[model samples]
Target: MTANKGLVATAGTELDRLAELYGGALTYEAAVAGGIPIIRTINEGLAPDRIRRVSGILNGTSNYILTAIDQEGLSFDAALKEAQAKGFAEANPIKDVIGIDAAYKLIILTKLIFHRTLSLAQLAPTGIDHLSPRLFAAAKEWGLKIKLLASTWESRGQLNYQVAPVALNPSHPLYQVDGVTNAVVIDSDLVGTSTYLGPGAGGKATANSVLADLASLSRGEQLTGSSACLRIENGRPLTKQRYLVVNPTGLPTGLQFSDRHATSALTPALTPTDLQRLRATNPGLETLALGE
Candidate 1:
């Protein structure tokens, strides 16, 4: 449904159907409507104010591809083939590879966690299809595992979300996650961080979770959800962005290097606004982040 434009109608109808039987719907679709006490609400005796952030690696295809490329030293094409061979990827794999698939899951997630609705066009998702296998291979050498992350957080009562490849160091819980496995990290103000790790086996996992929700709903669990007057952003300036501008020789004035780039990596640092400013300031600076 997310691949098409009728998701809002589909989710609404499913949620209303669930509402007929369960006081609040508990399926993932219902959870997308913010009616269920799923992870967003089911904190273990912890209140809402105590929770700070929710981030997850939600796409199994992307995870599997990256795992093959990084751990198994397969090229992007080979890794993608492997993912398809293992039944982790679709025959037409653009949605999985381009991050649209992850964005839909994130859209469902942002609605559940923040009580706000968002569409694909607004998020303008960034894809990993532009990512260089060389960049990931280098990251692996440095003990950094890259994962496509669906992250959402609240600041000043406004909630924001994004899906992007994140370079995780050893200390990050997501660093150890690989293959088609998925993991979600809920960072709170009190209990610190709780991580949920699972197989993320596409429709199989969805069916399993749906069954679990039915079992929970059978118990007549009741939870109240809140809808607030909140706004959404494509999100912040992304705390960290790794880049390897192909043709730039000397440093751009006032630009401090974030990390030592390998001589051949092709990642770029130009956010749209930054690219505009750079061109206005230094034209012929031939580099841009893949999405932009």
Candidate 2:
């Protein structure tokens, strides 16, 4: 059976069942970013030791809404409604906007990459619902954009995973992705960093992707094998260097200024730990920070 479905676990399970019941091969390819053709290249013989990072923008609805809000100055609600009216969003948008959709996709990608199955229940899922208009304004002030990023990778021997919104600088490739496009950057030891970008939503496009996969299967083409196996090492903790804007009148003493963005104002580089401490002290005022 050939089916072009989205990143819904039900679809995956059903396909597996059908493949088992009929004793025939079940193939899928059109389920990811709209029309992009991504074959599930899983080679059991390949080692996982060579992998580095798996990062990508996995949802089209959130990506579109973010781009509209940032570039067009549309309110989040307005953008969301527009997406719904245009059929870019599901009637029940919670799954798409809240990272459930991305979580499922990540699970599939991880299994294919590592030749090990994983469950969506094991992932740490965070959505973009917490983002505020003020945050968007702050991002604009710093010439950055916010995107919902879902990633899972194995390094050293530990697995790291997250689905959340991140503020990306203009220099990042994700910044260039706008509207309903989806892009993924795979960083590996052999392949420094390879990026794939294309339409990430829409039914017709998704159908095309699935059909392309079926065509390949018909031609007897095989999916690429997994990477070479390696020892999993503990990944280093991430420390962000950020721009913090705080009103000097309210801030406590002992906070050293990293640099001044303007004559009267200062932009201090603060770590997440430092920001947490500052917020704990003063929770009533506004603070701005930038990180890459």
Candidate 3:
């Protein structure tokens, strides 16, 4: 499971050991293709600058649920059930709903994007567990779309990473993304915003990708340098934070919910301390990151 820290670590360890045995070995899962070095190499091929920021919708289950809520007006429970029935979600769906799956993808992407390997613990991920369908309704009323996005970017010389529901205006490229399709948006100076969208489900996509990779390798094409070792720097810090708070509760003195009932806020970013305080006050409080 990508969401499980121990499991992800074990897989990474296996990848490490396997690469030692087989240099050109590749993992062709959609997650790996969408988040790892394959996409990184493509970005480099097209853009002059290396990847400075990477973000996207990494989980099909979560996207399916969000689409159901937004388009079908289904509650979280019903949407989750439908996703499970369609094989979009697992029987035990904790990882998909909670944003941990997306977070794990972000963690893996960070390894290549920032050249830093970060622990899941240090990431302080916030899941969609407590999210209410009302958030979607309110967002729709405001001409915005709600999507669970995982992002890694340089913020004030620090790499900020998180997986959370973020509101996007129609103008943004990701606003139209729906259903089980997956997308990754890379931002760099040369390329303003490069959006890649493809089916995140079905085995055929990954199978084809791996086959293509084998073809490339057989032709003696090496896209990236040796990734045998990682030089990790101090991981990024989440600072100067703000969140769209759901449910009226005791936020910090300076931080407050936008409206009592339903509304919006430009909203100051919450510090990690502020989130800890808010979470302590109300565990069920839901938050959406305002923007990049």
Candidate 2 weakest lDDT stretch, 10 residues:
40-49
lDDT of each: 0.62, 0.64, 0.65
lDDT of 1 by residue, 1-292 (tens): 1222136422744654567676565344222212222343433244454455678887778888888888788888999998888888889999878888778777765665566677777767777788775556556655667788877777766777777887776788887888887777777666788887776655655555556556656876543333344677557544434443432354444355554453323334645566556556653343322221
TM-scores for the candidates: 0.75, 0.77, 0.76
Candidate 2 segments exceeding 4 Å error: 1-26, 40-49, 220-225, 228-278, 284-291
Error of 3 at 240 (Å): 4.6
lDDT (Cα, 0-100) at 187 in candidate 1 = 74
TM-score of 3: 0.76
Q: Compare candidates 1 and 2 on TM-score and give the better one.
A: 2
Question: What number of clashing residue pairs does each candidate have, in the order they appear?
Answer: 1, 12, 6
Q: Candidate 3: which pairs clash? A: 98-127, 241-269, 241-270, 242-268, 242-269, 242-270
- Which portions of model 1 miss their true places by more than 4 Å? 1-10, 13-26, 29-50, 202-204, 223-229, 238-254, 261-292
Clashes of 1: 1
Can you write out model 3's per-residue Cα lDDT over 1-292, one digit (the tens) per residue? Answer: 1223334432664665566587654333335433223443543454356566777888888889888988998888999999999998999999878877777777767765565667777776666667766566657666677888888777555666777778876887788889988888888767678788887656777656656566665876544322223343333344565455554343323455454344333345667677677657665555565543
Q: How much is the lDDT of residue 105 in candidate 3?
A: 72
Model 2: how far is 250 from its true place, Å?
Answer: 6.4
